[model samples]
Target: MRGLWRAHRWTVASGALLGLSGALLAVWGNPVNTGICISCFLENAAGALGLHGNPRMQYIRPELLGFFLGSAAAAVLAREFRARARGPGLHLLGLGFLMAVGSAVFIGCPVKAMLRLAGGDLTAVAGAVGLVAGVRLGIALLGRGELGLGGPERPAPVLVPAGVVVAVAVLAGLAFVPGALIESRTGGGAQHAPAAVSLVAGLVLGAACQRTRFCITGAVRDAFLLRAAAPAAAVVAVVAAAVLVNAFTGSFSVGYYDQPGAHLQWAWSALGMGLVGLVAVIAGGCPFRQIIRAGEGDLDAATVCVGMVLGAALVQSWGLGGTTAGVPPAGRVAVLLGLAGVLGLALTRKERIA
Candidate 1:
């Protein structure tokens, strides 16, 4: 299949897979306008674990575990399961933290932004622009070749099974342990597709994504920095397919106002996503890619994932995230701070001009 993908238009295949997976997820029961939001799902999972007391958003989503395990399976099957854990863990941790915070403020990741656009949310346009602008800035800095983190030394394949084991244990607990995980009494947390459907969709999407190395941030970055269209083609496919599905399925509603779990604050949306994009590019992948990398045993990616979960908890607990009313002042301030931190990191590196 991997070889076949290489022979064919792999980008289209990947994008189609993502688009279909997202549409199917929505049909299967996720909240309207939200199919497979990595950040949002993580936020919900954090709430489920009692990491946050938001009763409106609590559920031990199985999709997170499914994605990790599925990616691990793909990596192992393809012999791409190399474990590399080098570089500054604190840097990755902090970047991941900022990535999560930014996404929380925006109420979505790059994927969600795209999905929102596909669902006819014009508010996501600003966010998408911010993402592109952020990537462009990262590309400019990357040209100087100073952004490389130190490389990993040893391969820790054991982390693969360890991660899978943890995922399985969590899934089992969510399934069998009554009240072990919190449930949302109302709001977005109360909305969900069945666990089985969501998990299966996640597993399928994870395996496909891992095989293709599909990443929303990477797609945007490569499109701009490397003049690569294949990845971008895949991303476009996701949007096109999602739009078609939503339109036919009656999920498409064009407008920013009254969008599910979203606000009409265009500037905040853009700035928030810009922060997410900037940090994601610096960190080398989007939120979902980080999860897949963790499954493949990249300790840095794992660290980032943990940081994202922590960020999610912090945002909800501290009221740093926005609600349907509008963007919170705290959230906007956090975006500015996150941008400052990312800029400092980008410029402080000692890479010589090419």
Candidate 2:
């Protein structure tokens, strides 16, 4: 027990903080089971920026901005902000878009799925299973030297950090200036914690997550790839902490029906998260991790963030998003195509026999 504590104490702390943050954010006015959902928040930010015209889905979330700016600050202070690009290809962008689509179909990202489970939503189980399966599949392919995107290189000094500065300015304009961005007067887009509160929460989370390298899929990935106990233990800590908070906050609802932001298409939920897991593995990060890394001056991650925002917009514009009614036929088809495309990418990627 002492050895385990020595190895996993920091992870446990990070996970506890993350879990408490999610639950408290929900209690503070963010949507239940959606305190730190990257995909959903990205979609909201896209709408606010007029990337999509969904009146019911437009808001500039300060928490989202804090994720980037705060992570950037952390990276800079830690002297870890070295701008590096992945090898040639639009592959990362495509993966990012596909990741968003997958999250849309599932109605949340891996983090949110876990939060939902913590809130006692049984439906998230399918998504969790799918994520594990997808991560396992990625591990298998990686083991065989398939789908190898080459290592990062070409350390441009100011590329990504400069872009992050621009993003901060632009996003701040939209967030603070009236008429600069559209806003939803109703629905989920209208629901949020106070901007100051959310931003502070986000800043704290970003710094902590960056410092700890916390990621839902990465945790699962490390468990498989390195047989590490700390990562998995961190995840368990998240669930346990959130569960305790949910129970105390009167937010725990132990059932599948009428759950907020959930769909009845269990198989599709699994597949959607499977796609998320697969793309996250290939891209070397999940949606939240991508945002953090982008702030850290990883141009590959920045490109992926751009793709994710584009995807967030496209899902609404193209009507490819799943709903509480269930995944539309188009959403299902899109997931299928995404899976096929992933397989194609794997087969076509430059082989590096491991």
Candidate 3:
């Protein structure tokens, strides 16, 4: 136990921070079990940008900008901010798009799935299973040399970081300007903690995540392929912290029926999250990780982030998002197609099997 603690102390700390912040975000005013949803925030931000016309989902989430800016700040301060691009840009973007689709179908990302579970939503169980399966599959392919992403990573122009930083600044500025962004007055998007509070939460979590490299899918990957002690410890820390906070705040509930922001389609949820796991492995991080990497001037990750926003917009505009009632037919088909498409893409990048 002492050895495990030393191995994952930073990861555990960061994970606990995320868990506590996630539950408290809702307590402070954000939607239930949605303290930190990358896909949901993308949907809201997309609507705010008029990429989609979902009024109930339109709002500029300061947490998104906070994540980006905070990560950039951390990377710059640590001298880890390198402008680099690798692999096929369009393909990497597709991974991000697929991640958005999967999260939309599951009604949340892996992080939110865990938050839901911490709140005692059993429906998230299927999602957790699917996520692990996907991560395991990704690892299998990677180990077998079937994933052809192995190549020399090329360095991008140093000016790339400047442009990315400027973009983050503009978005952060917009979050503060009155009427600069679309604010939803009716639905989940309308229900949010104070902008300043949410942004601070995102900043602290984002910076911590950057330093610790704490990622949901990455933890799953580590647990499956590498050392289990650290990843397991971090995962437990997140769920335990969230559970404790929820129970304290009267938000914890037993059973899964009628849970907030969740659906009963367990099979589909698994499949959707499975897609997320697969892409995170292929893309080098989950949606949240992609945003952090983008902040650090990784063009590959930046492309994925752009794809995520586009996917978020397309899902709503095309009515491909799941809902409390159930997953839409369109969303279902999209998830199936996304799985097939991403798998095909990964195959194309494969080398020889060992």
lDDT of each: 0.79, 0.85, 0.87
Note the residue pairs that clash in candidate 1. Answer: none
> Is 1 or 2 the stronger prediction by TM-score?
2
lDDT of prediction 2: 0.85
Give the TM-scores of the predictions, in the order they appear. Answer: 0.93, 0.95, 0.96
Model 1 agreement with the true structure over 253-314: per-residue lDDT tens digits: 99867787788887888888888877777777889899888777777788888889888888
In model 1, the Cα lDDT at residue 135 comes to: 76
| RMSD of candidates 1 onward, in order | 2.7, 1.8, 1.6
Poorest lDDT segment (10 consecutive residues) of candidate 2: 143-152
Model 1 RMSD vs true structure:
2.7
Q: Show where candidate 3 strays beyond 4 Å.
A: 1-5, 144-150, 346-350
Least accurate stretch of 10 residues (summed lDDT) in model 1?
1-10
lDDT of 3 by residue, 54-164 (tens): 899998888888888888889999999999887787777777899999999999988898899999999999999999899888887675553424467789997987787
TM-score of 2: 0.95
Models ranked on lDDT: 3, 2, 1
